[model samples]
Target: WTILRTRLGWSRQRPARRAVERDEDAIVAWRENEWPRIKK
Candidate 1:
């Protein structure tokens, strides 16, 4: 793995996988509305 990454410059990081039952709408709302409030 180290040799492949060093020689080939291949990334070992995997893509994030969301749950099948994840709420897209709620996540969007939280990011848009709630995140700004908490960020301050």
Candidate 2:
């Protein structure tokens, strides 16, 4: 892992895991609309 990180610039961090019960449409809507409003 250390060799890969140094030689290949690879990361050791784990990828994010989505919840099994997550709602795709809700997530999309939040990203499209609600997130922009919240960011302001």
Candidate 3:
């Protein structure tokens, strides 16, 4: 376990909630531009 953790850089934390290929810029644009319009 120690060898795997150290040598292979493994972690015990939970996986990320977001997608690996998620578009951050698009999400930001939607939040800043579209979401406000929709919320109103």
Worst 10 residues of 2 by lDDT: 10-19
TM-scores of the candidates are 0.53, 0.48, 0.51
Number of clashes in every candidate structure? 0, 0, 0
What TM value does model 2 have?
0.48
Better of 1 and 3 by lDDT: 1
- The superposed Cα distance between candidate 1 and the true structure at residue 36, in angstroms, equals 0.1
Residue 23: error of model 2 in Å? Answer: 0.8
In Å, residue 40's CA in model 3 sits off its true spot by 0.9
Clashing pairs in 3: none
Local accuracy by lDDT, each model: 0.93, 0.89, 0.91
Q: On residues 1-40, what C-alpha lDDT tens digit does candidate 1 reach at each position?
A: 9999999999888659968999999999999999999999
Ranking by lDDT: 1, 3, 2
Top lDDT hit: 1
**Ten consecutive residues with minimal summed lDDT in candidate 3?**
11-20
lDDT of 3: 0.91
Off by over 4 Å in 3: 1-16
| Residue-by-residue lDDT tens digits, candidate 3, 1-40 | 9899999999778865978899999999999999999999
Best by TM-score: 1
